[model samples]
Target: MAEQTQPADMSRWPLVIAGGFFLIMLAIFVVAFIVLSGEDTGMDADDITETAYMDIVTPLLVDADPERGREHFQRYGCTACHGNQNLAPAVDVMIASAGERRPPMQAVAYIYESIIYPGAFVVPGYQNNMPRTYSDTIDEAHLGDLIAFLSGVEAEPAPEIPEDDPLSIETPSGDDATDADEEFALSADGNVILTPALIREYEDLAEFLLAGANPERGPELVIEYGCSVCHGDLAAGILAAGYAEMGQMAAERRPPLSAAAYLYEAIIYPRRNTVEGWDDNMPDDYAEMISTVDLGDIIAYLLTYADE
Candidate 1:
């Protein structure tokens, strides 16, 4: 019999099979990372302690007033993320959980720890998205009042500030009444004390951003905002930078930051810096169009795609 003819491509079959297997493994890894990392875990209950926040809490306890704290709660926008807002545990739920975790845990101490070190014991099933700025932005006594209300503890009445105080609305005298613009002071602590007019303006702007970035509704946002046009569908390529080819292209730039940080800087400061191949034509008005809270939601939405 004539010698069996051999095809030239036959020798390449092994290499092709090995390549196919390697790709399958890579895909499995990517999927596994996404699934596992998406499950948020809070700080262990054992680690949360009353002493950690005692320095700040001790001062407030002397004059803690639950009623006064309730007002501060709304002023600082704590309602924006907790309870019915569904971003974090509701006030009642959090207190209840604290009670369960450490049966002997004092309500005041638990509330204090939560406000000062939110990340210390993330209520199970809640994201650790609570801002850590409360300790600084809220005076210790005011914070105590808030804790007092949340923990159902009775507190003293907060001292009243005079209505005519600079932080208060002032009667316009002379030609200033017709000026229509009230004096606005930017608090040194970065909290904006909005005048009624400014508050209306803020509400208008917030409405324009579609009730802020609904991170849970991020997929649609990517399309609505046309993010995919420049960055590609982030959901489609979660690890875009991890590819070998991308590493070579990004050799000169600093290592990429967290998805939240990068997206935030990109939106607020479009001209500040940009990705390697993209143009800087992103509308400069987004800073004025969206609230910082909304920007954070967008970042949170985008972070869902992060491989990490």
Candidate 2:
């Protein structure tokens, strides 16, 4: 067979073209990487703020201000259910009976959890009709105050509800398997072991925290913790429809950062990364004011409507 020689120049052209294309893609990748991971810049040396690192410590100490707590107990409407009427056990009753279960006689801890996550335990013969919104309505500190007030100062007696009142029915005993109260079992130590129910609730909370953030709780924290004091009025905040738009805006303003990341940074280190057109008035004391779990929940709630 006569050898039909291929041209060397034509064969080399393919390699050259591929090399050029590869270089172009590599350059683009480099640019995107730099853009996405860039640190806070464009501010003067003193103007730069550090990230607000949260410590995963045991929740805030229960050294509650009893007087302040008492005010909070009544102001937040604890009197409505827990008054002398026995609709819900009175503050003194819960305190006096605090050691009746296996759980440690941490009266403050018990009352604090009750106010924040009320569904975890119900006093025997008491209904679990307590509102779960207190977590949303009150901050951890104020709740601690409430616990202090309930632990030290007795609550005023509730006026008995009339027979016709829908709320007058007594809560079923824990031995009643048909009622949800059965889950609240007493511990061997003669104290209430809220661990089982609490464990279940925490498992659900773990899933919620891992499944993105709790944007629903975010806005509420923002208000309860007074975040809007600096972030303009996030009271009405943004709706779901505005999330994508807000994300895009956050990306553009933040440059290569996702809106979620930006939001997280804004909370943890408000002064670290300042948004253009906004003042550097964000408080840096959030690490002390908000717990890590509460911070996560708040972020999750905010992201629900303003996520990346």
Candidate 3:
């Protein structure tokens, strides 16, 4: 049997095996990071596209309506940061500072750039954390509306919302809606006035507790609750928003309502805002089976998928 020994390369087999295992683990970690970071709110600076540049700002700009802009300033929840909170500068202040920060750029153009691409030019002393995809989130026609308002230009008659008004709240009329809106108030203009009270109110909404839910439980609940039946990858569902992803979207899904409120309402009041492609097929009795605490947990769990 002529020594009957292994080849020299055989000595490297253990290293080769360990290296292969390490590569597999690295690939899995990479996949997970990609999946985790892939939730797109369309707000990244990188979200800017040529389409945005190609968009004719002139049409919206030329016809910008300050009054409408003023209205949208509230409607899109722009006030959350820009209002007395002053997380961002006042529109008038922005207009003045914009010219000095980036000269020959024209204050209006600079303002436009700041909006869709806020990272392009940071305000003198402010954090460069403004969302960069406002154009994607708002109506195209309203760009001029916002710009006109930012510039303090004169106004013309405003137009109706091309999309839902973020400041307004709507739900199916029923017992649940009563419970849901008990703490909320509407302005004379019919917009829900979000206040610090809303935060307090949301905290006390029940025991299910989305505020501090362990999101790890969300996927299990979806399967346990049969949400996976329709919204799951294996199911033939409408709305296309799978359970976990829906939590990420819950906030923007129905504005005026916080993410917790929207999730609660969507579960309890499925008859409202029926998805266009389907009849209101979501069972209305989920609230009966799921405890309020679990409901909060479920929402908390779902939101785990959302970006920070």
Which sequence of candidate numbers ranks them by lDDT, best first? Answer: 3, 1, 2
Candidate 2 residue-wise lDDT, 123-151, digit = tens: 77877766666666566666666665665
CA deviation > 4 Å runs, candidate 2? 1-59, 153-308
Which candidate's lDDT is highest?
3
Which has the better TM-score: candidate 1, or candidate 2?
A: 1
lDDT of 3 by residue, 1-308 (tens): 53347676876788899999999999999998887788664446566543444355556687777776776665444553564324568655654565566665555566677777677777766766465446555666667878777755663333332233422423334453333455545556442455666545543573346556677777787767656645778433432467666767777865666677766667764534444444334554465567766677777776666655
Query: Distance (Å) between predicted and true CA of 37, model 2?
Result: 23
TM-score of predicted structure 3:
0.40
Order of all candidates by TM-score, from best down to worst? 3, 1, 2
**TM-score of every prediction relative to native:** 0.36, 0.32, 0.40
Which digits, one per residue and each the tens of the lDDT, describe model 1 over residues 1-308? Answer: 22236565886788899999999999999999887775543234554455644555667878887766665664444543452335566666654555465446567777777777777667777677666655655656667778777776643333232322222322223331221243445455322343566445434543444344566765555444434433443212331232222223332332233334335545654433445443233433355445456565665565554533
In candidate 3, position 266 carries an lDDT of 71
RMSD of 2: 25.1
Judging by lDDT, tell me the better candidate of 2 and 3.
3
TM-score of model 1 relative to the true fold?
0.36
Candidate no. 2 TM-score? 0.32
